[model samples]
Target: MKKIWAPWRMEYILHVDDSVKCIFCEKKQYVLKETQHAMVMLNLFPYNPGHLMVAPKRHVANLEDLTDEELKEIMALTQKSVKVLKEIANPDGFNIGINIGRVAGAGFEGHIHIHVVPRWNGDTNFMPIIGETKVIPEGIEKTFKKLKPYFE
Candidate 1:
């Protein structure tokens, strides 16, 4: 069996800080775009090169808790995210979803957020299937920089 080396992930594995309960509540430096009620930010651990998350500014765990304005802004931001990614990343398709609970695959179970994953033709390959690893061609910081200008 061949091994995939990802030394960068060690930082996430070793640093276990329980104090910061909700990641969405914190002031994010890498927020790509924001409205009065919602914001979009790059995923620190992305599924693809241009993966992003859109969420309501208020700390709401469920979709039912969102106000009409919040819901509108969140969906607007999600749409904008896809548009921007298409321009910059030129993805063939997208996977946009919101995992409501932990069982539904939400890493931040208490915060409702939508994930926008950009996909290209033949992006899924042997690495993820056989090696159990996902290879991101670009660095997160680099990708953040590429997408930041369009949002601004």
Candidate 2:
């Protein structure tokens, strides 16, 4: 049996009480870019190396709740996230999406956000299939540092 050490996941595991507060509403230390209406930040538990989330500053669960300005900024930031990931990670492709509710896989169900996941050729390996574990190749802090400068 091979062990994959992901120390950062411990923070998420210990602090995953949703009743504490909405994650998007909290002071995000890993924010890559922030505008008046929206911000882009690294996903604490990413699906891939450069996984990011774009969300409106205002807490709104539904898409209909977003103001036109907020919607625009969120989309713009999403595009910027893709560009930055392309330059830094050089991914073969991307998976950008929004999960509306718990059933749709929205971990933070009350706050609407867009997920921008960078995908590479051969990124899907046997570990996830057989071992039931996904491997993240880089540390979150390292990825954050690499991405922050581009957003600035």
Candidate 3:
């Protein structure tokens, strides 16, 4: 069994700052895609290199709260996100999902978001199973820069 050393997460885990800002509501410097109802942004703690999240603009705790327009926009943005990742990374596949509540593995259960993770061949390794860590090759800021222009 090999142990994956991810020292970078220590900063996020150790530093606890009290802010009322919701992860999805915070105005980001870089936005990958945005429609009237939804927007896409790079995931700060991603499961893969080209990981991104599609979220509704309005604050909603669950998918059921989204209107038909918001739902359609989010899905459309998700598809566009896939296209961008394909053009940029040419990933072998993708994993798109939404975790509803805390019990469903949502880090921010108060806001609804869909995760789009680009997966390459042999992307899955023992690190996740043994060390419970995900190894993402690129940083979120770098990925944000790479994807931001595509949205415009």
Candidate 4:
């Protein structure tokens, strides 16, 4: 049997604790950039390399709950994230969207955030298509360091 190794996910698998604080709320320490209404941070489990999320600081579950200001700020920060990704990773393309509820694949259903995933021409392969696994080239801390300066 072939094994797909993504040892980072072990934390989520082993700690199954429901008492953990809301990610968007408790993620202040992990924030790369912040505006009054929103923040940008690296996704702990990414769909692709340099995948990051833009989340409203207000902690609303549904996108409809976002204030006009929050909406504007989230979009603005997303654009900035793209710029940072371009400069740091030079990805060929991008995929940006939000998952509002659990059925929509939101791991954190209580917070609304936009996922900005950087993509390259051959980034997708049988590893994901057949094996159902994603391969991230760099560690999150490395990605965080590479992206941190741009937000500052």
Candidate 5:
């Protein structure tokens, strides 16, 4: 019997960084027109590569707490991100979401987000069950290169 190891997860497991601050907010200034939170970038650690998180300029926790304008921006940004991600990643499909809390897997649960992820057939597999990991065939930097041009 043999086992298949996912290369992408190695960087995730071996990779470490200064995560004390909100990376989304920090990376925001690099992007144009999308505002601070609307700034979409490649996920450093992605589910299947080309996974992105879209947020609001002002950070807020719960969805109900979001102002109508904030919600509008978030949605609009999400839609745009989906299109950009599709153009860049060219996956078979996507999985967009917002995890409200730690239990829901927000990571930064206090900051609300809309995830725009590119999905392909058979992406969902036993990696979680078998290896306690998620397999991503590509690297984050590559995804970033594919997506960065769209930030303008």
Candidate 6:
């Protein structure tokens, strides 16, 4: 028998066991930057080397649900993570966003958070055009090193 490999769809299948919730919540409970779910941890797969996601502790699906303090913390942490990403990946650009609902492309539709993704020149190519696939060029742990300091 033979098996098929799908690098992108793997996201639907592979993930940290306890990481389905807000990552920031996990960090608040444990060490600051220790494990895979640390504040600066990388995407289970990443679009670029320093791409990072910073979320809050409590799970609030709606962006409007965030308190003033949570908003402040989110901004501050995002600033920190961006700084680290610049140092580590030195990307040519960035795309930061929050996907509020399923239509907005939030994989975890019940959890709300922001995505800070570093972009390089021509990261996408014929694969996306011809094959309808995305190629994430960096490893998760490597992204962690680049963006970890912002959390600490």
Best by lDDT: 2
Query: Over the stretch 1-152, how does candidate 2's per-residue lDDT look in tens digits?
Result: 96534344445555568665788897586989999999999998897888999999999999999999999999999999998899989999998999897766677778899999999988877776677678899999999999999999
- The order of the candidates by lDDT, greatest first, is 2, 1, 4, 3, 5, 6
Q: Looking at model 4, report the run of 10 residues with the lowest lDDT sum.
A: 4-13
- Taken over the whole model, the C-alpha lDDT of each candidate is 0.84, 0.87, 0.80, 0.82, 0.68, 0.62
- The parts of candidate 5 lying over 4 Å away from their true place are 1-21, 26-33
TM-score of 1: 0.86
Winner by lDDT between candidate 4 and candidate 3: 4
TM-score ranking from best to worst?
2, 1, 4, 3, 5, 6
User: For model 3, where is the 10-residue window of minimal lDDT?
Assistant: 9-18
Instruction: Point out the worst 10-residue segment of candidate 1 by lDDT.
Output: 4-13
Model 1, range 1-152, lDDT digits (tens) per residue?
96534444444434635676777887575799888999999888887898999999999999999999999999999999999999888999998999887656677778899999999998877786667677899998898889998887
**Clashing residue pairs in candidate 6, if any?**
25-57
Model 5, 1-152: lDDT tens digits are 96645544545434434474565556553232366344455565677777777777676788898888778777877788888867766779887888786655556666677777788887877876576777678776666666777766
lDDT over C-alpha atoms for residue 47 of model 6:
58
Could you tell me which residue pairs clash in candidate 1?
A: none
| Candidate 1 segments exceeding 4 Å error | 1-17, 27-29
Q: What is the clash tally of candidate 3?
A: 0
Q: Output the better candidate (4/5) by TM-score.
A: 4
Please tell me which model should have the higher TM-score, number 2 or number 5.
2
| Candidate 4 lDDT by residue in tens digits, 1-152 | 96545444444445634685678897455589989999998888787878899999997898788999999999999999999899889999998999787666677778889999998998867776567566778888888888899999
Give TM per candidate. 0.86, 0.88, 0.82, 0.85, 0.74, 0.71
